[model samples]
Target: MNIAKNMEAIFVAAIVIASATSFATAAVSTPVIAVKAEASAMQTVTVTAKRLTAAEKAAL
Candidate 1:
């Protein structure tokens, strides 16, 4: 019974450690990935102009 309790404690500890490490890895890697995604997802706008003709200006 004592050996079974020790085994259960060890198993729970191992699971907790594994979950902590997985979360730590994700926290470290998420920012770099988010920066790359934001850079790629960015967009730009362009503007252009043209001079109006005399007839069109007179009509207006």
Candidate 2:
């Protein structure tokens, strides 16, 4: 395959641009991921109340 010199340059530029975009995307999404993780963790606990005992259930 005969690749021109400018084609090599263009390929290099495209790789650099893709790398930069990947880094930018990772940086921007990190905090969003953290926030989502926190929200999911928070949601994991339905409530803090303890399960009612048989006696407690009878009292109700």
Candidate 3:
């Protein structure tokens, strides 16, 4: 039983690592559309987000 549990833990870890690397490589290798100023005239953009409170930070 101990050996079985150890093997399971190792297998789970391997799968997690494999999935992580696959996703990382997929994102890096894919060609994605890019924004251009002349084509879309989206020269300037502003982004805003809500600030988290101290309690939220502590919870995380």
Candidate 4:
């Protein structure tokens, strides 16, 4: 019974460590993801502007 309890404690500790590591990794990568999303948004805006300009020219 003592050994079983020890093994359970170890298992819980391992799970906590893994979860903490995952959170840390996500935190580290969040800024990178935000930057990528910002760049993508800028590109989309630029493309939309160009399309509008072309459409205006066509209308004229």
Q: Quick one: best lDDT, which candidate?
A: 3
lDDT of 2 by residue, 1-60 (tens): 556858988899999999999988888744544434565466544567899999999999
Model 3, 19-41: lDDT tens per residue? 99998988886588896567566
Residue 3's lDDT within candidate 3 is 81
Candidate 3 weakest lDDT stretch, 10 residues? 35-44
| Residue ranges of candidate 3 with Cα displaced over 4 Å | 1-4, 30-60
Model 1, 1-60: lDDT tens digits are 687769989999999999999988988844554435577678988768888899989999
**Weakest ten-residue segment in model 4 by summed lDDT:** 43-52
Model 1 / residue 17 / CA error / Å: 0.2
Single out the weakest 10-residue window by summed lDDT for candidate 1. Answer: 29-38
Over the stretch 1-60, how does candidate 4's per-residue lDDT look in tens digits?
687769989999999999999988988744544434566466533334334577788998
Q: Which pairs in model 1 have colliding backbones?
A: none
Instruction: Report the Cα lDDT for candidate 3.
Output: 0.86
lDDT score, candidate 4:
0.75
**Regions of candidate 1 where Cα sits further than 4 Å from its true position:** 1-3, 30-60
Which residue pairs collide, candidate 2?
none
Q: Of the pair 2 and 3, which is ahead by lDDT?
A: 3
Candidate 4 similarity to native, TM-score: 0.41
